[model samples]
Target: MTDETRTSALQILRTLVGSPTADFHEGQYEAISSLVDGHSRALVVQRTGWGKSAVYFVATLLLRQRGGGPTVLVSPLLALMRDQISAAERAGVRAVAINSTNAHEWGDVVAALERDEVDVLLVSPERLNNPTFREQQLPALVARMGLLVVDEAHCISDWGHDFRPDYRRLRDLIAQMPSGVPVLATTATANSRVVADIAEQLGGAEVVTIRGPLARASLRLGVLRLPDSKTRLGWLLSHLGDLPGSGIIYTLTVSAAEDTARLLRDAGHAVRAYTGQTDTGEREESEGMLKRNEVKALVATSALGMGFDKPDLGFVVHLGAPSSPVAYYQQVGRAGRATENADVLLLPGTEDRDIWQYFATASMPDQARAERILSALERERPTSTPALEALVDIRRTPLELLLKVLDVDGAVRRVQGGWVATGEPWTYDAERYSRIAAERVAEQQHMIEYETTTSCRMEFLQRTLDDETAAPCGRCDNCAGAWYPTAIAADAAASAASSLDRVGVAIEPRAQWPTGADRLGLPVKGRIAAAERPLEGRALARLTDLGWGGTLRELFAPGSPDAPASAALIAACVRVLAGWGWKERPAAIVTMPSRRHPQLIESVAAGLSQAGRLPHLGSLEYLKGGPEGEPGGNSAYRLAGVWGRIGVPDALADDLAGLAATKPDSPILLIDDLVDSRWTITVASRALRQSGAAGVLPFALAVVR
Candidate 1:
């Protein structure tokens, strides 16, 4: 960056250092400026305190200044909404939060919003659900919603950091909006899956992802492996030794937060702790006092979030590892907001890992079984606690998770009277049957891959679960290490054209998994690569790839052989692969939508050959915006595919080292669909050559529109 940008960034960092938040870095401002200046929607998949709120806040200001429609910040909490409104007011923007909890003020807020008088409209999803907001004011509110800012957006994804039903309903909310009012989503932490899911849910908006650097150059990151609570408490007191400004200590449980706060206060340090379960007046008093510096440290549960913006918080001490890395990142991120040299103390207790893993790897009750259990409870009338326990294998805790899901889906209700099924009886049984077999198999396969793979641990993870499709993933653990793909000793006994002989294989003898089977532990099997009906899933996939022709029923019919042999042959291979812990389902395969290849094809082809995951990357769309973004293709896959058709080696995977050695003008070409962000391909290819490929190339269908 230029001197001006650098100077401004450091100044902001300096200004916010003593407050209690660790956001407002130079990089955050630059990223936010770039995104707002671009005037487009983006997914901010950043860690906490990377100034995510400031980004949206600044974007709102810019849009207002530019006469954009009233910026709608869809915050989840009423308190957070009010805070944003207050912040905006501090900057002199006409911000208002339409919280109708009081009922009396609801109409006034609605009328103000209808007239587009509000510059930024912050409202909870529940507020949006009201009949008044839905039927009257909501319908007309969108044309004025030039910037649809979805704050804390992950609640929408089932696989998000935190899943809430109200959040999922926002999908319908966006669908109800007036067209062309671009939606911009901001979140403190989102992984790769969350990123793709966000883009997909947001109606295919281009992802202007700003991955804030995870390193806090100024903050000292120290993880103390504590043996017990006594030692951890001692460490905390020692660290607190007269660092004047302020610090925040986080605990996983409300009781812990309270106890810690109590002990610290008793020891003569002004301390405060807050939990979601804390009483209203007491909670307010605690927060207010903490903010005023009456309390030198605030011990809090994970219940705190983006609403509070305190700069210059000197340090953040964690009692233990959080539920997820994302949580830890966001919490520590709250520290050093203004401290150029801030510190993050991560006390990953030994018990923390085991405790957290108990939740993570616990055998989840079958989704269907849980649904049925609740349905039974609902239909048969609310039974007594003992009666309910006796009727089913469930206890209160796991039941609570599913109950939460059911509650969100509006499938169940809790009344003073008892639990009752609400809304229509959603038919989960049909969907359940369609998934069970495949889900079991797929999950097993993923486990097998992870445990069996000879490749770099980071590489396997990045590719298998993380799915970083871009050519260059230099920042990942895999890109930093050597890769050694396992040479799965292909049993040469079975020739390529030989039938998958299944002679003497147990027909229904047993369902026992073999030794290595435990390793491939994903949830689904075979993706139904070739199913018996509807003919859409893995069934269509296998047929298309194997270059076979037949109806789904006929193919799966009893006694029918696949391709060149008997059903027995193919069944044998399935058994063998299963025993070896191969993915019971066919791996994710692909087909390009562009059946109409250009006679005088539009692609620039060179050095493109598919390999590694090249085959899985699917087809490249040769479009300058005719259509983009299918179920599987992202800009990364689209780029690789376009390069694939350009006569580049199809083995065009994410190995940057191999691609960098190519001569610039050689006949060898690398092609992709298009370059919305040329940096992905450019970086990928640069790394490949850096590894050792000398005959590399570049090609694509079109430049991004």
Candidate 2:
């Protein structure tokens, strides 16, 4: 607005970019002015690498110069926080973060904030509700806060692709902030509905929304539909090196990422797997390696999606299509940020829809489960998550997520001991949730349309983001006719097939009983007795594997008949058993009773017994059928459901009892079609060992992690 203010902002911008000619982008100047000069709430929806961080950094500097307190920045991911901290330092702004990784340094960070030394403080949304931090440190910071920034703010709206419950807590923070404190929410991918929702949550009608064009002219987008996983891997193995520079290869599942990365590395290419299961330290290392171009690519999942910054990334290849066009746009935006030309390709799989449905269902809260949780909390004192899991029928992961949603909705509060009911009237909005679910299904269909569309791929993505300026880019394969090669070499295809077809997954035994199991009337307590537990088991493949996952899904789908194991799957199971490397070879194979797939289990056991030259001692039959309901729930409930259901038949008892006399310490190989909670195997093995069997070793066709 004023000459002096412009000059100061421009001076800081130069330092931020390390260039004397650096200036704000299209909407950066407006956002900065609104936050600094106007002291107003603003929401900026711009494409990635469009200087969103610059607006906040410049505004924070200006506010600090005016003797304001430290700016509190709520960033979603640790990777993003790391990048923002580095950028802030480049501009001579004192920046630090209080996250899970840097717990040892929190006291020093708090001291700096107390002394007014921190120019900007970046924190994860989960930290906002930390008991000690919220009650002690956060209040002081909020009282003197100059500005509040929400990075990846699309997460605040449930309609966004990556909805996070922790992010919704920021609404209370915004409401509690001192009056006149400017708040800025920034995101690269937000449709009109999501943008409106975020603005409403921020300041309701008064929130200033500045949306820019969502087109990325530098990207050459394309879609290549391969027949199967092997062909897709073949195409990647053949053409990945041809891309401009080091970039990312995203997969829909962690197993796919790891398998792809392993295949690439084995072929003398530098690559690594980055996923949610990756260790924190290793994830940081992988990020640095990718940023420095030390590796050609990081095969990843959505874990590396938002807030990862690499300006010159040359390509982004999706091994499987994302569920929504908006999500695809966000991930592909990582490429061509600071390059003249970058390649983007989508390899959509038939199995993508199934994965989409699994994740989408996981995101929606179950009304009945929510009501159960609330009712349980109402009658009790503060209850810990472990204790609650034994009482409720939900698993730990979904239970914790549901608790967060309930906490933010004011139906519950997390206290020092645990969670307690707030007695607030909370209604289950089934209508809104159903609408969101329907919207998700629509997005999945839209993704299918994106793959099939012959029009400009860039235009399709831009339109998905609700950009009114959507048009042909004249660069995508659909517009320009296939810039990427589709040919796959014979040798490469063979190698990929071999790599993908290889299958064997270790099934770790359930070493300890879940907490509070005793309260559920089960004698099991902390550590499961070693003698009663089944030895470390082996599975032919994971149910979520990139190779065998599809076949297993079809076999396990509801209403699917009980059929014998296929020749190829049985052969794979034999290979898994061959590579088992157990301390003692089993003298007999015992199958578990499967109400749904009895033929499948017996077929697998008979095949393995014939191959290994071991006796097929028949299956453990259920006294009164198997467990009620489907497999899944807390450990105590699952164990209770399975206990006493399976037992060794009298016909097999004589042979099992003779194992001690014939082959002193030989193990009995307990075979099953699948393993979910491992409780059935645990109970069955316990029954066998109690019947004079020396030991029990479990083997399964597939493992559900």
Write model 1 residue lDDT over 587-704, tens digit each, in one string: 2222223333331122211111211123233333334333332312222233333332221124443332233333232212233332333433433343333333343233333332
**Model 2 ranges off by over 4 Å:** 160-162, 378-380
Compute the lDDT of residue 425 as modeled in candidate 1: 67
Candidate 2: clashing pairs of residues: none
lDDT, model 2: 0.89
What TM-score, computed on C-alpha atoms, does each candidate reach?
Answer: 0.51, 0.98
Error of 1 at 110 (Å): 2.6
Q: Tell me how many residue pairs clash in candidate 1.
A: 83
> Whose lDDT is greatest here?
2
Q: Quick one: best TM-score, which candidate?
A: 2
| Per-residue accuracy of model 2 over 236-322 as CA lDDT, tens digit each | 888888988999999999888998999999888899999999999999999999999999999999889887889999999999999
